[model samples]
Target: MAHSRLQNINNLTTIDAKGAGIYIHIPFCKQACHYCDFHFSTSLKKKDEMIAAIITEIGMRKNELEGQVIQTIYFGGGTPSVLSNQEIQHIITAVYNNFTVIDNPEITLEANPDDLSNKRIAALSNTPINRLSIGIQSFFEEDLKLMNRAHNAKEAEDCIAAAVKHFDNISIDLIYGIPNMSNQRWLQNVAKALQFGVPHISSYALTVEPKTALYTFVKKGIITAPSDEAAQEQFLLLVDELEANGFIHYELSNFGKQGYFSQNNTAYWLGKKYLGIGPSAHSYNGTTRSWNVANNMLYLKSIQEGKLPSEQETLTLSDRYNEYIMTGLRTIWGVAVARVQQDFGQLYYDYLIAQLQPFLDNGLLSFKDGIITTTRKGKFLSDGIASDLFFLR
Candidate 1:
């Protein structure tokens, strides 16, 4: 792992300017949520073996990283919380043994409500895990039931209190703009999180992914399909409320109090390289991107046979520039025109300025210094703007 950001006050594109973040994916969930499509299994038959394999994978790939320092380690999941304290420690310890961890590297574990009981929370608090990303989704029982989430409303509300007693760097995830979720109810969810003093929150709209239970339910009329208008309204409401409360909307779906932005995810938005381990995990190193097999069983089997079950592609310069525009345009950081010119050359710079004229005239984009950023209205339609600005060459 190198530094996750360019902090040397010198060159920005130097390889060492950004250190790598390590993401360890755990493909086991206690139960499936109606809307989730991430790879995982309810079965724990091979859970122990899976842990060993994960640790082994880290050790084996240590050389691939060429002894780089790891600045952040994130255990994202089907539900990393499903792994016991000992299991979690094993994975962390293995990484420590194989790679050089940066001083005070950000170590995060994505957990759920049901797993945060006093005992379990205490066990986790005892480890090097300092941050928790809880899946609260909604604070209403009816909403929880509709999503078939593993935990109920009570669990969702209480888990944060328990977690806060142990860790201050807590981030709660919420879903707004679900089908028929009223503005008032969304307000209640936000208020509940703020009342608990959660340092960070990641809230998102409920979009229907293909082959998900939520998608099928909507198609069959068992559940109403998500509404774009309501989602947009709710998103606006969330942004206004959180910002009023002194939270910064650092990225599109994320809000952090003061300096608590998600370090691992920030590395991602800045186009830093990272190694993603486990089923369905993704890796990008500025030049290339790769992903693992989505099947847990197959993933385990492939790695066991001394082969990583993943596909890789080296990124073209255009691919990297387009990706930078796509991601950087979504955050408060926006796009630096000088940096763009330096990396992509004057031709790309001319192309970007040409594209910016309409958006600027429409009040959706602004120019200051040598950077171009979206206005508030631009954020709501960021995807379309990014599509228009993408360099196909």
Candidate 2:
């Protein structure tokens, strides 16, 4: 079954997502890499305490869901690879005991290439986690050093070999457009990842975000800012290479090898209701959205005092419509005009139709099966166009 045709007014205050997905945040890492801005501390100082609290929070927040079948369970992290097999299993068991997980739910765990030693891979094989997303940002030694990623070229290649022996649903991440990278090396990186025969690959163009170590270094003239022209050229080339190698360009930065899409993430892009647990985790229950504190200490203290440790807002009609436009436009499924009308009323329906006519006339978009999606050219400017067609009222 698919998610909802409707986007508003689900049974809120009903514990559990009606067709919810469960996301457990494993927020501890061995080191902080440059160009990384996610909320994780290098100190595993409170690792044990945090792990215990996450499980506790699951039980405490269990009633927030509706006892529906959980379609996916994803262990996203500071680096879930840092977690022990015992810790992983303990969390999985906690989820099973507290919630009604569906039969054959897709459980994915994200890892780092350096952590994928033979012993660890073999240990992970024994767990229920059927999928592994290894962060192989680049296969070039210089790029790895520049980004301060925890893996070398050898580890990048070897980790996949280790993982493939034990898991079929494997996805590897690659970051392209490094200032020091050449086209030849980028091509090699793509070829090497494909050589492992992994089912999915998520390739991203590197962007220097604010307050990151890379940002600081660039500001101090220690390193150059990202080259936009090079980034664009590399992205185009990467797409061509992957598509030629039989990968589907499922999303802007994601390509799936056949039927191996990341079900958990795909659900999020499609706006499925998923509950996030842990510090900095966000939860959606249809109309209102909530997120826990990003600070580990703040989250732990609040939950200890019997508070949800979260902030929430009820989504307005326009907010929901704009959200639908953004998420739905980025997918292969496209935006279904009829479904929008059914959920958001005819004024929204008519407004979108009228707004899109210019793009439709310009051949930047196409219409069929009562849905509208950007053509390949328009997809490059998808964000701007999607916003243009949104209902602002």
Best TM-score among the predictions, by candidate number = 1
Q: Please provide, for model 2 over 1-393, each residue's C-alpha lDDT reduced to its tens digit, 9 standing for 90 to 100.
A: 111112111222322245678998888888778988888888888888888888898898777777567878999978988888999898999999889887667788999988899889887877888888899998889999999988899998998888888787888999887877888888888888878887688877788989899999989999988887787777778878888988877776788865677778777777778899998899987799998899999988887788878899999989989988887777677899998999999999999988988988887788888988878766656677898988876
Which segments of model 1 are wrong by more than 4 Å?
1-18
- Minimum summed lDDT over a 10-residue window in model 2 is located at 1-10
TM-score list, all predictions: 0.95, 0.92
RMSD of each: 3.6, 5.2
- Model 1 lDDT vs. the true structure? 0.85
| Candidate 2 colliding pairs | 15-64, 15-65, 15-66, 16-64, 16-65, 16-66
lDDT of 1 by residue, 1-393 (tens): 111321221123422444788899999988889999888899989898889888878877887666467878999989999998889999999989988787777789999999889778877777888788999999999999888999999999888888888786889999987877899999998999999998789998898999899999999999988888898888889999999999989888999886678888887888777898888889877788999888888888988999888999998888888988988888888899998999999988999998889999998888899878888777777778988999986
Task: Report the Cα lDDT for residue 290, model 1.
Answer: 92
Query: Could you tell me how far off, in angstroms, the CA of residue 9 lies in candidate 1 after the best superposition?
Result: 15
